[model samples]
Target chain A: MGSNDAVRKVHRHPERQRVDRDALYRLLDEELVGHLAMVVGGEPLIVPMAYARVADALLLHGSTGGGFALRAATEGHTVAFSVTALDGIVVARSLFDHSMNYRSAVVYGELETLGPAEEDAALIALSERLLPGRPSEVRANTRKELAATRVVRLPLADAVFKVRDAGPGEAEDDGEDHHVWAGVVPARRGWGAPVVSALTEPDAPLPPSVRRLIEVPG
Target chain B: MGSNDAVRKVHRHPERQRVDRDALYRLLDEELVGHLAMVVGGEPLIVPMAYARVADALLLHGSTGGGFALRAATEGHTVAFSVTALDGIVVARSLFDHSMNYRSAVVYGELETLGPAEEDAALIALSERLLPGRPSEVRANTRKELAATRVVRLPLADAVFKVRDAGPGEAEDDGEDHHVWAGVVPARRGWGAPVVSALTEPDAPLPPSVRRLIEVPG
Candidate 1:
């Protein structure tokens, strides 16, 4: 629940910054994808990657032959992974104070490429994270398939979470008219109908994991 | 309508790589936020920023005082700005092929801080992007408010766009079961009911911008 190093402290919005470890873990677990960024060729390069939180580390899915994440892992560069969720819109009387309610976290760490037993464990963890309770419903990955995928893990030792969940901010005697509309409009993400593939049998039932996800309201 | 240089080209999935300028412009215009990142102190630093596209450049909103983006602008670092939209989940027959249907773009370039007249225009563009028709319904920003904000612009010259909008991918003779249910689960984002501030009159009519945004279904 304490601060990381001085270099990664949240300075811009001190009020919104959170130092709790649970906040960091919760943010990582709730989001399915994140932006992984690193400097390459003297310019910043960032790409969205699918990730899963397993304990205190992040398992990033990377293709052995093509993924830039793999290159970052090979180079042992300190990478940044960012996850953000937009909560709502904060409407204010003045445009200057208009803001978005959101929760964001940025983690700074070096990615280590996993091998052998750890790689299989990371892949299984990633699968469960993406589709809970479905690992048993699926077949095991062939050796060739496993060999083509590279799993990289980043320890969650240095991260910062910032959240803005309240209503619009108004300054004291800001001189704006009182007869204006100001409030918040909540935003959310939801899953639509599960589309069965045309090739699959029409009567095949939906997987339990998929059923539970859509049945529960977001 | 052409590709960028080799260093910034999309080599991972050439089929998903889009060279059309309209596609790149549409993706940037549709998204309200992006992750701006650079290598600072030999570590990657990224922050989520509200941005808008005007012509061929991105205008990012940042605090002039404590924002890391402001520091990046002052340092003249070649920053990376990434925007991604997760359209849906492609539920394959096997977890090996499971993937997310998404459109992602990573732009490599430098951020230039806007000047007097351009700053005003950039601010307006950003406001319109975040909330359409909002500027007309709100009061103009004060001189001090304007001075405290910094708007950084990044050209869309060196960029790459990749999109996966299809259903599950199945390999020929991959030795997988035929009876498993597999398809795409569509995902969507929506806005909830607007909560009017308690301070405002209960019967205060909603602004035209707010009314239009929520009334229309996503």
Candidate 2:
């Protein structure tokens, strides 16, 4: 992937770290959630949350009444957010060589509140990201509902993206002699049979976005 | 799935949350990796890393060279660690009721370094926790390796164990028509085929512990 963005770096094994704009965009678009990490009193805390993408910024929405979210908004602190999917485990002969093959992104930035118009757009982006076509199916957010929720963006800057995909390497000692079972347990994602809400008609078809989900080896 | 030991009221669904001592111990044992959340400098951060459990305490293995581990060793600092598994998504009718069915333990306390004997015990326990019987197959840790790796343990106290599970609650307007998909995607765990070092014999049978893995539906 080409590194067209300022926040991304090739890092060591530039091949392993994708810095291209398209790759980064796809990574963000495919994942539905991220773990947001920040330093509180110098200790590390992580929160798993959902998110949406809009151009160069990623939108996060939460209740203004939430303790963590409120503290994050009021303090305006810099935070690190990561989205990772472990595809498989790479087990080698030596313990130290045992590692996981995964796609991960670490983004560092300060939270910025969305402006009046941007907030609405961000929510739409988030709704579409999570439910896809359902954003149009559900009733639009009322003025009161919008006022109660908080939306903010964390720009794509100071980020590191790393990935490793391949089978395990041969042991250093007698290469062919080490006979151990070796293969990958592929991770996958897919929607289960949809359940019609108790209030819905018995045979309402699944929405396009939910139905159109593509399975990727996790 | 009893409320006998649950820490959070909302997370104490009997059918969804589990409290078997053996099960909890096994959950912590079979898993070699987890997310560590800490409060440093009044901010929260989550670090995803490998971990090992030893007896009644959880040992966080790290290097003196790493910044986070290094700062943790300094006196007069407190750290809280949590391990969470998202078992399934509970898609309720109302947005306010939407939640995840998960198993998590939040540990609060100051971390302390293990003594020489405790370090040895910790490493063995960690090995067993990660690979079960493999501690016997692999060579024991050398004094140098033990000395090189730093092991810090947080006592089991000050921990809040929580979980949630069950189907969505019926909407108050149940007779009214609606169109929403709701169901569950059960999560399962077991040992994948183990990778033998390229140098191992091609037909070595896996140790009993690894081969006799317990598959649990979370």
The parts of candidate 2 lying over 4 Å away from their true place are A1-33, A39-45, A63-67, A94-97, A163-177, A180-218, B1-32, B38-45, B54-56, B62-75, B90-99, B161-176, B187-218
Question: How close is candidate 2 at the interface, in terms of C-alpha RMSD after superposing the true interface residues?
Answer: 6.9
Scored by lDDT, the top model is 1
What would the TM-score be for candidate 1 when compared with the true structure? 0.93
Clashes of each: 0, 34
| TM-score of the second chain for every model | 0.91, 0.73
On residues B60-101, what C-alpha lDDT tens digit does candidate 1 reach at each position? 886211375567445766777889887787777667788888
Give RMSD (Å) of candidate 1 vs. truth: 3.0
Q: Give the distance in Å from residue B163's predicted Cα in candidate 1 to where it truly belongs.
A: 0.6
Weakest 10 consecutive residues, lDDT, candidate 1 chain A?
A63-72
Model 2 chain B lDDT-worst window of ten: B1-10
Task: Please state the CAPRI-style docking class of candidate 2.
Answer: acceptable
Q: What value of lDDT does candidate 2 attain over all alpha carbons? A: 0.54
Evaluate model 2: give its TM-score. Answer: 0.72
